[model samples]
Target: MTNISNAKIAILATNGFEKSELFEPRKQLMEAGAKVTIISLESGSIKSWDQKDWGESIGVDMIVDNASESDFDALVLPGGQMNPDILRAEDKAVDFVKAFFDAGKPIAAICHAPWLLIEADLVQDRNVTGYKSIKTDLINAGARFEDSEVVVDNGLITSRHPGDLDAFSAKIIEEVKEGIHKRMQKAA
Candidate 1:
């Protein structure tokens, strides 16, 4: 396995992102030695949804239109009803997601965040799991939806809800480590 120190990971979300879903994983990834970048539709700050009320403000490292998929090791999408709903409408966000898929980079999406994956059309033929409500949407979009806490297919990893944060964070780190290892092997 490659050392995770300094590995770069990008998170895509906006207002109403599940506070824990975004912040918790971000904390874990950073603690594990990965640099986390929060990219959003706007370039200032994004609000989050805590359990009872709005949560912390996260700075926007880059605008979605300005971020290149080649600049990071993997992509993360934190789910909240409004977050993914808005993200799916942003062309840059969809394209960025497509870039990760086309480049074979790992992507971890949790809760309602998979809506962006469907918008990017990456769900077609991919096995995924998401918030229970979106299962039909995923199925209609050609994804093989599963009911699970965490589902990893190829480089795509997904989780069901905010409660799955533990599993979600662990899987993203593992994928990032594995991704770097595979890239190093190819370069060697």
Candidate 2:
């Protein structure tokens, strides 16, 4: 496993996030010694959406309105049908995501989370993958869509669904450890 002991990673999400997609990656990153912070739209706890029902509530460590990309080494976007949908519509959320890209920070997203990437206008000319339901949306946004478990383009890591959590987490850790990517730096 990659050691990201000094990396400050931010997991940005809101209520209705896919339970496994959020928790699993956070768990794995923390286990690998990375400092993982849950940055949400609010200050209180946010509920998770399990497979078919509401899941646990995770405390928000920071508010997106107050977060700065300079303070984090990487970002993780967990997906659920409602989570990304809600986040994509929030100007603050979309701007926060764009800052990470602007700074060339590594970003890992799964399932519908890429919707925010689309909202931030960061997917153009990039190779990415997400939940099958959003495949067309991704392609329409100019992203080279893939159906693989995990697709890494520059510093952007994307996966199809919760089932790809292992690979997603691993790639995030690896990318974070590798630091900034040249492509991302150029874009920035």
The CA lDDT of each predicted structure is 0.88, 0.93
Residue lDDT tens for model 2, 38-128: 9999999999999999999999999998899899999999999999999999999999898888777898989999999999998999999
lDDT of the structure predicted as candidate 2: 0.93
TM-scores for all candidates? 0.92, 0.96
User: How high a TM-score does candidate 2 get?
Assistant: 0.96
Residue 148 in candidate 2 has what lDDT? 99
The per-residue C-alpha lDDT of model 2 at residue 96 equals 89
**Candidate maximizing TM-score:** 2
Clashing residue pairs in candidate 1 (N, C-alpha, C atoms within 3 angstroms): none
Worst 10 residues of 1 by lDDT: 179-188
Tens digits of per-residue lDDT, candidate 1, 58-117, equal: 899999888998999999999988899999998888999988877889999999999998
Worst 10 residues of 2 by lDDT: 179-188
On lDDT, the candidate that comes out on top is: 2
Stretches > 4 Å off in candidate 1: 1-3, 180-188
Clashing pairs in 2: none
TM-score of 1: 0.92
CA shift of 42, model 2, Å? 0.8
